[model samples]
Target: MMAGPRPNALSWLGLSAVLVAVDQWSKWLAVSRLEYGNPVPFIDGFWNWTLVHNYGAAFSFLSSAGGWQRWFFTALAIVISTGLVVWLARTPRSDWRSALPFALIIAGAIGNVIDRIRYGYVVDFVDWYVGTWHWPAFNVADSAIVVGAALLVVLSFKSPDTTGKGG
Candidate 1:
């Protein structure tokens, strides 16, 4: 096996930086260009740009719990981000399956944390619906988080062994 520092590694966190920048830029654009509580259809029957603020986690789980969820989520994101940093540092560059998901998670968690700190809530804009069954509005950060989680699930199934060896 070839040795001496794996090539094109993610330890530098370049992709994480890009994801975070793109997420924050998109959110900024949404806030600047879109009207709150208004649904601007991007597709006839699939998607739309509906701006909304979420005060809690996925699907606004604790959105109704006064305003304390803000700090709670912020702290949680920080902790998660810290863990991701450690994972990224320890992860081998060749482990794209793990590294990509970890970077994505870091981008998403930190992106949402920024919103929580700046506005006390997350700025959600992407909206999808089918007839009256509408999905909750979410932003790029949410998308990254979901995709990263899905990728992690797929990786788990792809390699049933928990050990990072014997491939």
Candidate 2:
């Protein structure tokens, strides 16, 4: 007997769309309701809703590099997101381990790219801190990227199944 056609993970794009919508909506809310550079406390000395803009990559890397970084980052995001989308199309539908991460990273990359193209900067609002030490302010897209990348890293270490059973 011949094997039938295999299902692809393209359906998981729905998750990406939902995530992008939520990311964009959150950024819109932050822009509309919060004042730039001001911290609105969400938790006592631990968290805040602070509106800020980042012109570069993670943790504001290269953010101050004269005007070119905006287009550079935007193009980079487009390329990365495009590649992941292609990967998603090739992935098997049953491989949630791979599909989930690809979907999340795609959503995040596209989400930030939209901001960069429209506003010349990525909108950031969430702020976490401890005492005087503070982590960088980031948005929903950044969170998704972080989680997705982390999952990819963790899953990469899974040992192969020895019993010939697909895992």
Candidate 3:
């Protein structure tokens, strides 16, 4: 039997919750402490805490799309998060490799969703730079999503069967 749902499923969900909490907390800290358009250097050459808002999908795609993209992205995130939770619930408890990435993705989706619902934009603060060149500012949720996507890429090469568990 499936034993209903494994204990580790809850554990994985718990970890996802932690990621969401941390992501939200870090965003809160940035919002409270950082001044908009001003970069606070965290590392001399490479990193800075800079506050910005993303109203679009990754890399600000559709950010310029009037105003509906916020709702579009929010709905998309909810759908994806629901799907990930279902997958996480079905996965075997011992399957850390698969569960880890799905959990991260869920956390990230929800984190951004909260932002969309609350402020209509995601609060991003991490700024990476090289002298005059700069990467777009991003936040913890963005980091989680990227890490999860990267893990999925790595796992895909390691094994063709990468889906977590059930429907």
Best by lDDT: 2
TM-scores for the candidates = 0.88, 0.93, 0.89
Per-model lDDT = 0.87, 0.92, 0.87
Q: Which sections of candidate 1 miss by over 4 Å?
A: 1-12, 160-167
Residue-level lDDT of model 3, residues 1-167, one tens digit each, is 45564465646988889999999999999999999879999998999999999999888989999999999999999999898888877776667667888888988999999999999999999999999899988888888899998888887676534465533
* Residue-level lDDT tens digits of model 1 in 1-167: 78676454456478888888999999999999999999999996989998899999999989999999999999998998898888777776767888888888888999999999999999999999999889998888898889988999888778533575645
Arranged by TM-score with the best first, the candidates are 2, 3, 1
Query: Relative to the unseen true structure, what is the C-alpha lDDT of residue 12 in candidate 1, on a scale of 0 to 100?
Result: 46
How many residue pairs clash in model 2?
Answer: 0
Best by TM-score: 2
Worst 10 residues of 3 by lDDT: 158-167
For all predictions, the C-alpha RMSD in Å is 3.9, 2.1, 4.2
**Candidate 3: clashing pairs of residues:** none
Roughly what TM-score does model 1 have, to 2 decimal places? 0.88
What's the candidate order when arranged by decreasing lDDT?
Answer: 2, 3, 1
